[model samples]
Target: MTITELAKQWQTVIHHKPPIEKDPTSNDLLILIPGNPGLVNFYICYLDLIQQQFPNFEILCISHAGCDPNSYELFKFYGLKDQIVSKYEIIKKFVMDNEYSTKYNLYFLSHSVGCYINQRMVKLLLDDMSLVSHVDIKYVGLICPTIKDISKSVSGVRITKLFNYTPIITVLSILSSVLTRLLSDNYLLGIIEHYHIIKKPALVDFVSQLNYTNSTLGALNIVSKSHIVKQVLTLACEEMKLINEEKDINDWFFHDLGSKVKVWVYFADSDHWVNDKTRDELIKDYYDEDNHNNIRFELGKSDDGITHSFCIDKSVEFARITTNAIRRLN
Candidate 1:
């Protein structure tokens, strides 16, 4: 289907392949939640790889509200709580409206800030059994999760330091928009390829098809707005600190989700956004020593030149790693 056809109200996109049969297990779905600048098209390459691995699963990618430049007005209301609540509501509505809970096993795949949002969504599902009783959530994958001390992380420090200057970010945003408009898609693809931002030649076509200007603007807005960025960083730090407490760690990890749901967390060894310190802390605090059955962690190779945004550039390697993790879950 075309990008326009996939686009839905509130800047959401749902991509699904037609089911081959009426069986619930055969019609299982994978829902993707992207990080900041949450452009659904940004994940096209990653989703394509996943579809190749599991052809039976339908995929849905939801962009954050106001991520689209055309709906920039929604930015005013895009607070932390608002984002989580809206995402939760959107997922609930989609599942209920399509009767997916009765016919499909749902899987969640989240990246960066989406991991935090997905945790909250899972907490909500656990809290209200009535909402998720019929739903079969098979697995959850969190890639490059920024779950703690984000402001202190290498990438966060670099990004926050640069974006601390409002005028600079604003100017950069405008310049980016202008450049995106001026450059031909081929030229842009060539530039990205030269920098190795997109290693897979096949993915260049999909990247070129996206609205670069809009995506850039959305990303810039997130970094430039001090209040929004501060709020998110603060929330993550607080949650991490809370989880570190001995009493809360178990509930934070398990939350009565039971044995059926499997969670896999993939961390990059050299990820500046979520560094070794944070990753180690999470493992120390939440890694279950007793059973160690449902949760697992896989670390990426630092020498592989994988960045925190591996999904965008290292699509093929990222897919292989994620596919291996999925297989381990089964």
Candidate 2:
């Protein structure tokens, strides 16, 4: 089959059958949760790398409501999505029902905001340990996780925070979201600034090619043309308001860390988008890597030609590092 056809077939299988069930009887299953607005295509390259290295593993990729192109039909606006938290709750329920593993080791591959959801899920699991026994979730692979030390990381109104102001930021956020839906999944502006893919062979072209081949853009358009974007955008606006109003309150620091899971953070040495202070706090406060060796930090050297978006870069060396990490965890 052509690459495009194969991509579509894979999407079909994933949608129909949970990606997490790749190896139900296996010792461990890799669950990849995407960050921000993204499709499975975003991580296909990485998945390909993992498959080559460890051919005997099961891989499940979960695209959250706000992140999935298919969900855009249920949420069109994009900038004001409040149901994100609710969507995550649903995912939690799914995990509980399918593999409430006390013994089955679960490894996570998360990127950016995906880490936030993963942490939240871990907290929920910790709350009622009986709902799950053992909860053998270990080795979280976070690619530039967006767990911000709110006080230090978040500055004034970021371009994304436009959703906080209805007439100004909200309008722009909606416009950009829709424009991205219409123009291209890997559109240059969307790829670089918002998505932050700073790797070579022009990561934009690489992602764009995948989107085109995989029909990701088309599926996304289907959802965008529906009412999903509107609902999701409205939800985002509400969340933005919560964020804004809560700024005066200094309690947004991540208190979700527990001894249930181990973490492996992969971050660039210098990423302007994700502040260093925030990273330090995540290491110190959230994971307590300073005190605990369970959570390991691998600072990618930008000087050696790595950037913030190394997760999806086309560089062979970059691919090797990424695949090796997943293999080592396995």
Candidate 3:
């Protein structure tokens, strides 16, 4: 699938438009808000699969600001809220430029922290009296989300301890900047493939499953050219501060957007980022069939072997699961 990209510096939003000859009929828009380290480079295959599934819908993704190195600027930070607003503005501009005045479905396909951004984007887009309300948020597919109480999760606890206590973000940013200057892309790729550095067996499994594809290379390329470590961790620290609350999610989405939008969340069999108990509690407390009939949850089995960072090797499988969920949405 050839992706048509609108690139501005490293900040890029890629889209797959059905061949003009095919002349797509559906006016739906599906926007993919990528996980933190918010580069859309990791999701080429995922978007391709989704485009194949819904040939009519336009599939688009924007890389999070400060994460892209293609036009490297000093590593600055855009917190989680900024990311949400940025995406909303981009989507809104696209809709306005295209003059999509008639009501149409807006489906949000997001991973990890992007889920939080997705929900917020939906709220913002819906509530915006300025935009004419042509874009109705129809569905939100949250994959391995970190929407609430992340500080309580295992990974969240570790990250909170590290970020709060240590100056790791600054130190690592300087270190990564130096390393990028010293190292070659090929060298970095070798290290990534060989697990020469911090080799978490769980994460490398994504690279192991998929050979050195563009996704893997792009992941390394960003690190080599940009000090995104600071940007990533900076946003992460803010996420720890802001995303600890979930009642807000219940207040806005389950109550305000209930039935008007369908929400599907897929959970990893075991995710350090999302607590299992919290996941269960969310299902039990909020999912009253009479009230929140628009919400549905999918759980991965222990042997399913899909990780939270599903964009790497598991992109195909995750895409299949997500597209399947989209098919079921009203």
Candidate 4:
């Protein structure tokens, strides 16, 4: 879809509209937040699917400014023109202001880098008294959250810091793109076919994993252009600076300062992006699993032993049912 069409669809799905006027009869509110400075299209598309399934719920999206001209140009370069993180904050503030006035169970479906942004927003809402009483944020659905240390997830992401050079990777990337494009029309056709398969809630995640891997190779080419590379570089630098400012990463991330929020941890059995042992360790260290008072950790597992991208797995039907069961808590 074109950028304008995507934005319009996003606004329709996220913002409170005439047809979707905040209904008092609705039992729950669904917030669909996307990851990174890019991915506006993916966020909206997923939200559209969920909105259809849960029409009564209010589905809102929070987009980060990582894809703007001054921010991250990854998406913009790919044709997503407007980078509007400011609009997301406005919606969040609105939710906060009236959070106490209404009573609705809250659900958050976040993807990729969006998971980090949602975590921060959830933290903020938990801290704010005005919003805490109005809604019960019962469940959070995360799709392949970016938990893998970049150094380990992708080969040279970390090494870039040490080398401060982009020649080798850049040349390889450009050459590869040329070769792939020249090989045959089959290459492009294959990509198009894969793109369609990814739309299914079951296949969405696996496709995402493949795309992420492919994109990393393509990303090297962008590094050759200072303006393009600056986006990733600046974000990385700022992220590190933020980490240094904080005493601990888990403390910064998993703090349950909000109203009785239960968490639904979704993962594929074979997901390489999410290190199962490490994630389990983090969960054990950060959250007191024994404390049933506020948190309930419902893990989504693939019976067939699937890999990291479990978001759109065919087995997600089970996962969604499990998620809905969590929502039925209060």
Candidate 5:
């Protein structure tokens, strides 16, 4: 798969699966967006699983602008808002240029911070009556979404504590970048195998393709930049507050896409980044009479031991749950 530049300064890895029939009834497209450290390769296993289940659907995963492993830079002028806008532009261009809105059904699968971008993109589409009227967005699946203030959450507090040591994070980022340049994919694979971190051969291959330097730099940017961290935390907190107050969160944030699109939200039972308290609160909000029909929420089994980064350790289970969720939409 080659990386294509979708927009000015934005590049994405595309995986196209042509429809079996020349004129199939449904030519659906599944777009996956990763969270902080937005490395598209990290979701390869999950992508592969979904493709296997729905062979007719084409999948596209976009990395953050300038976040590709080959072009790792320490100081890039990219932030949360910029990332979201870039994604919106990329998707809008693709759908309009290919007439995908008329030819295909659209589904968004977002993880962590990508859920924010997905919501913003949906809002953009909703605001453009001309564009939205033609587009048929069937479903949106948010996996381990960090949509509310995480600072007060279990994982947020821990991450905040870790970020308090700016020097350590910077040093680690620099070291990781340097090591990534020196180490071969095989060497990394060997280390992972030695530790038995992942047993599946296909998943191991997918992970081997990641760009560590880019991921490290992406992580560093999110941790070191006060403004970026503040923005994410604030958005999450405000969203929860509105939901708790029984305000029209859909109208306020999603531009009413919450009503138009079927939403499946998957949350890990013990996610540190999104604590149980906040997760339950959001579930209650989604279950409100107004949203009960549009939103479907699920919590991962506590015995499964899934973490915030389930893509790494629980890819198969994650894929299974996502597949089941999408099936429900059908």
Candidate 6:
């Protein structure tokens, strides 16, 4: 299937079917939750990598409510708590619809703010007496997590400042939508700042899907869906407002520690969307290389060139990194 087709398919609201009941690995369920602008489209390449690396593992990717393309039929917006609840309900249904078993182990793969949702959902599920004894949470993988004090992040600070001018942003989004219809075929702007006669940036260098043709299409999608633009901005504002506080805000910092679940974290050396100070402190306090090493943290090398949005440029490489981490679990 084409990359665009696969991404569109992933955006569906239906949960993926459980692994083949007879397969030995059927008991293992891996769910990927993407960050804000939680469209599953951005992570399609990464998902393909994981599936290729671990064909036996059944995977489900969840897009935040209102991010699905089909959901555009109706105009609705969801906030942070709504996302957490929606994800939890989806997982619950996935579990219940399949054969119930105590042998099942749940695994979570998350990116950006999805990391925040993963932590809360894990805690919430564990707290429930109904499923508490029925299922086990085995592993959690966080890529460039934004789980704590997001308001303090570089981008968070900048975006939060923009929140005060939401009316202006909203108006611009509406204008962009109107202009998008007139510009879909050729998206280049008549700008002297750019040296190239280029219509699109060199997205092919990082990711093939970022080429001139694809990027023009992407721009059209962004502009045509003004609601999505507004939703993304709204979500960012909500994130800055609510995704604050230290690690223990929900008493989740210490929950599902080394003994209960194995957690792996990979972060860029420099990320505008990350609260570096908070991430460093969490690593120092919670990471243990020796015994009780439930959480393993990897800080990127400064020269490695991976960024917060690694999926676009390094999906294969990052997928290899993650699959390797999971394989090493004892």
| lDDT, candidates in the order shown | 0.62, 0.50, 0.73, 0.46, 0.63, 0.68
Please give, for residues 44-123, the per-residue lDDT of candidate 3 as tens digits: 76787777777767767887866666655555567777787777777776776564336556788888888888888778
Q: In candidate 2, residue 29 scores what lDDT?
A: 52
RMSD of every candidate to native, in Å, equals 5.9, 7.7, 4.3, 8.0, 5.9, 5.5
Off by over 4 Å in 4: 1-27, 43-53, 66-88, 93-105, 126-138, 147-150, 153-191, 194-249, 252-255, 287-289, 298-307, 310-322, 328-330
Q: How many times do residue backbones clash in model 5?
A: 4
Q: What value does the lDDT take at residue 232 in candidate 5?
A: 40
Q: State which candidate, 4 or 6, has the greater lDDT.
A: 6
Candidates arranged by lDDT, highest first? 3, 6, 5, 1, 2, 4
Q: State the number of backbone clashes in model 4.
A: 11
List the candidate 3 regions with Cα displacement exceeding 4 Å. 1-25, 99-104, 196-212, 291-293
> How does residue 45 of candidate 4 score in lDDT?
36
In model 5, what lDDT does residue 90 have?
72
Give a tens-digit lDDT track for model 6, residues 147-245: 888888899888887777557557867876677566553443322114332243344454444433333333344446666776667788888888776
What would the C-alpha RMSD of candidate 6 be, to one decimal place? 5.5
Of candidate 4, the 10-residue stretch with the lowest lDDT total is 75-84
**Evaluation by lDDT, superior candidate among 4 and 5:** 5
Per-residue lDDT value at 263 in model 2:
58
- The C-alpha local distance difference test score for the whole of candidate 1 amounts to 0.62
The digit string of per-residue lDDT tens for model 2 on 256-328 reads: 2433345567876776446776677556545553425555567787566666544444334555776767655
Off by over 4 Å in 6: 1-22, 99-103, 132-134, 165-168, 183-220, 249-251, 289-292
How far does residue 152 in candidate 4 sit from its true spot (Å)? 3.9
Model 5 per-residue lDDT at 10: 53
- Each candidate structure's count of clashing pairs: 0, 24, 0, 11, 4, 1
Cα displacement (angstroms), candidate 2, residue 82, comes to 6.8
